[model samples]
Target: MTASPSSAYPYRLRLPGPITIPERIRQATARSIVNHRGPEMRVILEEIQQWIKPLFGTTAPVLTFGSSGTGVMEASLANVLAPGEKVLALVHGQFGERYAQIARALGAEVDVIESEWGWTPDPAVIAAKLDKNDYRALVAVHNESSTGAVTDLAAIGALLRDRDTLLLVDSVSGLGGLELRQDEWGVDIIVTGSQKALMCPPGLGFASVSEKARKVIERDDRCARFYLDMRKALAVVDKHETAFTCPVSLLFGVHEALTMIHEEGLPQVFARHKRLSDAMRAGCVALGLPAFGDQATASHTVVVASVPEPLTGGAIVKHMYETYNTAIAGARNKLTGRVIRIGTMGLISEADVLTDLYFLERSLTALGHAVPTPGCGVAAAVASLS
Candidate 1:
């Protein structure tokens, strides 16, 4: 299924920003599908896995699955954790809360360290919890997309270095968009999806497992879910492949995307995301909207902003879509109707930033909401970047 540029809303400003498929990926997919278990496919899978390791800053094997980000989340729990094991689950937003639910459903004893939706959990608090508990694993969402907050994985890793706790991280939105040092941070299992900063369509899930986690899983005799077993997945990886049918299209896209990322240089890619995020936040602040996440814990991909009392987030979104032809994400759950999320990852540019700010101001004014001026947001963004 090729995406047509013309099919996109002509005048609509895409707030979520669209996925970018490089020419190489298109050509790769154009090749006839081969047997996934064959040697040729095995070589491709190995190369993809090798390419993914550096992106996660880990030398460990990265397991690829034909599933969504949630699949990896489920796999992490089912494979490494046995029923009745104790886990420290940190909850700062919707994604973090998911770990708590998944862990509980797996019959694990879950101890949660809850923080406000828009704030990050203090590393000290995480350390305190680890100090008192003999938990089997510590689970955290490195970047909470729902709240646009980034947890300090390095600090959390430091806290767990002295302990026997396995650090499991959900970095679905954090991996390629920000600076993530998985091996350096001592993360045991790190998970990510293709749809975020990887610049690919959704459906591919990835996880890099540490040697320590591998040993623990190897020692456990419990049977994991057939489809989500990490041990079986690793066994296949040893043969340079997956246990089940993989999403060939998405894999093709990932392979191409990684090449594009390499060509651009990882440091430059990260800087681009950071610059776009800063521009978006500065634009919002200039328009009188407050950024939702704590400045210190802000993510480079998405920026959550509180809508003014008189101007609802929905109204802003609607105006941007109908009038300006721009799309933006709304708040999730408790934050619904209260916040607007602007994404700054994958194929976004300086022009996109300025255009978004311009339309945002116009949309607010058209909806009878207060905004500073026509170019105030753009000006503020420029000044912030300077």
Candidate 2:
């Protein structure tokens, strides 16, 4: 009999993520299953709790759940902000809107400050709004992956300082790849996933809650959610445990990934991302392709460039996969057919970026799309490493 389809390697990917995983992390996660509540699991959870705090830059309570980043989005609004309270959602792209949606669904009155599709939220705009109104909390996405822009967190955070209002951030794609200081930045709640910068498969959602946010969670009696309740989770965490069945394998992967990040040193990791991002954009410039958003606010974790005339992003995505054995992403939601995206996170090396660009140049040329400047794309990209 022929081999099963699952037996073969799927797409050869250079995704905007769930990107490639490292060998060491894969090996660590492959161990035989262990009892979720046993002593073995206890050791793992405790270790993760201590280690993950540094990444978050939080001395506050950092919690892990076996759900996606959206889960924490729900938990944050549901547990802390009471019904009928007002929340200001600063939205630039898709993920920022997601924060507002979750808050609205959970009964908080959402006041949204929206910008153009490819523009990041102006901290000045948000600050002006704050001065005129009283809000229970401010919700923002640290990185807007869909439009490839990053919000100004430092400016936003500074505005909220020492105030009654709390700050919630979705750092789903930024946490492990970018520099985020939870406590220093005065971010009350920060959430992320294992799939993005952490260099692991999707399954784990990590969040950090400040003492001020925890008190709000503790006192909210009107809406009692058991499964995703921060207080309930924290009680068990006190014993280094989970309130529900956890993904044991994913926990292992997260631990190893975090260990690898610290070993490399965060400063080095950050510098590497900056280099790769600059190179990717330079390549885009060389190819005469416009990136989706403003360069000033572009994300360090993702790059989105406009597809030239005579081809949609989806078509190019397909062509690149079939003809070149690579997989980058096409646009999603409102931006579909307009732009192509590349992930610059989680084990994607400078060399990998170069290889992807080389093939990208070839694929675009194969599609009858002329390279604006022959060899310019690769040259500018390669120079960024030096």
Candidate 3:
């Protein structure tokens, strides 16, 4: 029988996220509750804004959501764009399409600029799409996590900076881990989750909004959302409180996680993630598994590699998780058994990468693939790190 949810599974790690939290943050998550409206909580809230601002590249206070990153994406759409406004939602993967779905559900006339699963939406193509339609906003994912494809937001931003449309970015997996400058990129709205690169478990999410988007939200009386109304939520910003009761425990954990990020420094933190990603890509190369896309657009967050003929992604994932108890993510839904997705997103070092590589090589070998050089994958990875 499988281990119970609460039971400790026999694995070195479980996931890229809900990733192994530092012991201190884990303890903080379990700490005694504080009143969400109390003075102590106010201090925590104030500190969180200060702690999180640099990550989002915003001087304006970031809005916190008591849900997943998708929640923030939906909330952002609901709060800013009104009914009948056209939104160009770029789709390169599942999450990108998700943003489109949310827009469609909310009555926005959605136009999609789609690319193949393993490729990122081209900025020039997107720029042309914008010119063809008088779009109110452009919804794009900075890093297409589902396919391990990274979009060129900087180039996209350069094209749109002087345009009339707003740029709403879903940087859920890219924000803290990858290089993202919301303000510098002229991203009107940016959303991210706590689980990915924040070194915390999933629980809360937040959005950083620019002045233009804030005004658009303030003036869009047609927007009927109550809970996600940034106007309502920001009403008490000076008081360091939210529109509703906040999750104090998750806030504690996020704050602790942000503290850890600060300790590492953002530049070094991003570099560490890059190092881990490089090692992962190198190891995959040594295993004779080609990456899903070229290195230029590859995600620093995760490595998506094509599963060779006769070696199903399902079998390897099953063997890794069930037999070795080392969990790695699989493909985007449509091509489930065709590709394997592995993440080095949060709280992982070279040692962790080595361990995961060892398991992946062994899993492939056990499944009848030839590892011409038994330890080469790990060696390549280690050399990349050094």
Q: Number of the top candidate by TM-score?
A: 3
The 0-to-1 C-alpha lDDT of every candidate, in the order given, reads 0.83, 0.84, 0.84
The predicted structure with the larger lDDT, 1 or 2, is 2
Query: What's the distance in Å from true for residue 237, model 2?
Result: 2.1
| Top lDDT model | 2
Instruction: Estimate, for each residue in 1-386, the C-alpha lDDT of model 2 and write its tens digit.
Output: 32232223354567777888899999989988899999999999998888788878888778888888898888878888778889999888888889999988878888999999788777788889998888889999988888888877888889999788899999999988888888888899999988999988898898799988887888856365988888888778879898899999999998899899889998898888878988998887787677777888888888889877777888778777777667788977887898888899877788778877887888788888888777878998988666
Q: How far is candidate 2 from the true structure (C-alpha RMSD, Å)?
A: 3.0
lDDT of 1 by residue, 1-386 (tens): 32233334455434443344445766766667777788878878878887788889999989988888888998888877778989899899989999889988888999999999989888888877777879888999998988999998898888888777889999988888888888899898999898888878778899999998898877665435888788778888978889889887677778878888888899999999998899999999989999996888888988888987877887777767766556787865888888998878876788888878887888777888777676889999988777
Q: Provide the TM-score for each candidate, comma-separated.
A: 0.93, 0.94, 0.95
In model 3, the worst 10-residue window by lDDT is: 1-10
Writing each residue's lDDT as its tens digit, candidate 3 over 1-386 gives 55433224466563545567778888989989999999989998899999888988878768887888899999889888889889998898989999999999888999998898878887788878877888878899988877888888778778778887888899888878887777787888888888888867786889888888888888756457988888887778768998898889999998898888899899998898899999998998899788886678888888888888898888888888876778787764887887887878878878888888888998899999998699988999989988
Any residue pairs clashing in model 1, and if so which? 11-325, 12-325, 12-326, 13-325, 13-326, 13-327, 15-327
- Candidate 1 lDDT at 12 equals 42
Query: Would you give me the overall lDDT of model 1?
Result: 0.83
Give stretches of model 2 more than 4 Å off: 1-10
Model 3 TM: 0.95
Candidate 1 segments exceeding 4 Å error: 1-31
